[model samples]
Target: MNESIHVVCTHCHAMNRVPELRVGDAPSCGRCQQPLFQGQPVALDSAHFDKHLKGDLPLVVDFWAPWCGPCKSMAPQFAAAAQQLEPQIRLAKVDTEAEQALGARFGIRSIPTMVLFRGGQELARKSGALATRDIVAWARSVIK
Candidate 1:
C-alpha cells in the first residue's frame, strides 16, 4: 500500500490526501482543482491560517508587515525559500498589519518572525529577517 500525506489547499483551504510517492508529480487539490504546490508562499488571513495549521504537512509562516523595513526586505527571500521548500513544506505569509488579531494571538512582538507548525502545533520559531539560504536551512533543520 502507498503511504499518503495530507496537504491543505492554498486556494480553498480544503484537506487533500496525496500519495507520498506522487507528491512531486504536480498534484492538484481535489476540491478547488488548483495546484497544491505553487512554488510560492500563500498569503493567509486569520481564518485560513487556522485551517492550514491543522494540516498534516509542516507550515512555515512569515509574520510580516508592509511598514516594516526588514519585513519588506525579506519578502523576496521568503518567496525564494518557498520555491526551494515546496511539496515538502507549505510556506505562508501573514500580514501583521492586516491581521492584528493573529499577531496578537501569536504574540508577535516583532516583524519578520518565522513560525513552523505541524499538525496545528508550533514546532519552532525564529525572529528577524533571513536570507533565502538561511531560511531554507533553518526550516529544514527545525523540521528534521
Candidate 2:
C-alpha cells in the first residue's frame, strides 16, 4: 500500500488525504473539489493559519507588511517560488499590517520573514528578501 499525506486546499482551506505518489498528478480537494495547489501563494490570516500548519506538506509562510519595501520587492519572488515549489510544498502570505496579532505571536521583528512548518511545528525561519531561485534553494535546503 502507498502512504498518503494531508494536503490543505488553497481555495477552501479544506484538508484532503492524497497518496504520496499521486501528489504530482494534480489532486483535488475532497471537500471543495478545487485544485490543492494552484502555483500561487495562498493568502492566509490568523483564522486559517493554524489549519494550514496541520497539513503534512511543509508550509512556507511569508510574513509581510504593505509599508515594508523589502516585503513588497520580495512578493513576486515568493509567488514565483510558489509556482516552482508547489505540489510538494505550500507557500502562503500573512499581511502583518492586517494581522498584527499573528506577527506578534510569530515574533516577526522584521518584514519578509519566511517560516517553514511541518506537521504544525515550525522547523526553520529566514528573514530578508531573496530571489526566486534563492527562495527555492533555501526552502529545499531547510526541508532536507
Candidate 3:
C-alpha cells in the first residue's frame, strides 16, 4: 500500500506528501509549512480549481459566499468533515462571490452547495447545509 498521498496546497498551490495511513496525523505544507487543517476552509479560485478537481484524488468543493447564512453555518461542518476524511479526500472551497465564472460554469443556483469530484468527474452535489456525519456518509457512499 502507498504510505503517502499527494495533496496540493490550498494556500500556495504546492503539492504535499501526507501519510495515507495516518489520517489523524496533522500534516503541514512542505513548501509553506502551514497547517493543512487550520479550522478554515481552503479557498480556491479558477486559477487552480480545474487542476485540483482533475487530480488523481477525491475532492469536496463547497460553493459558498460570505453573505449566505447557510453557507456560513456549514463552514465548520465542512472543516470537521475534512479532518475526519483526510488522506482519502481533499477539501476545497470556491467563493462564488469571487469566482463568478466558476460558479456560473458549475451552475450554482444556491449557496452552501457541496460538490464531490473524483478524477475530474462530479460524483455528487447537493444544496443546503449538512451535518458532519451526513457529509462523511455521503462522501463514503460516492468514494470509489
Cα lDDT tens digits for candidate 3, 1-144: 768766777678777767776545767888999766544456889999986765556888999999999998888999999877765687889999999999999899998899998878888998899999998888888895
Q: State the C-alpha lDDT per candidate.
A: 0.93, 0.93, 0.82
In model 1, the Cα lDDT at residue 9 comes to 91
Cα lDDT of model 1 by residue, 22-128, tens digit: 99999999998999999999999988888898787899999999999999999999999999999899999999999999999999998899999988988999999
Measured by lDDT, the strongest candidate is: 1
Clashes of each: 0, 0, 0
Q: Candidate 2 lDDT (Cα, whole model)? A: 0.93
Q: Taking the tens digit of each residue's C-alpha lDDT, what string does model 2 give over 1-144?
A: 999999988888888999999999988999889888799999999889999999899999999999999999999999999999998889999999999999999999988899999888889999999999999999999888
lDDT ranking from best candidate downward: 1, 2, 3
Using Cα atoms with residue i matched to residue i, what is each candidate's TM-score against the true structure?
0.97, 0.97, 0.81
Screening candidate 2 with a backbone cut-off below 3 angstroms (N, C-alpha, C), the clashing residue pairs are none
Cα lDDT for residue 61, model 1?
94
Looking at model 2, which ten-residue stretch has the lowest summed lDDT? 6-15
Candidate 3 accuracy as TM-score? 0.81
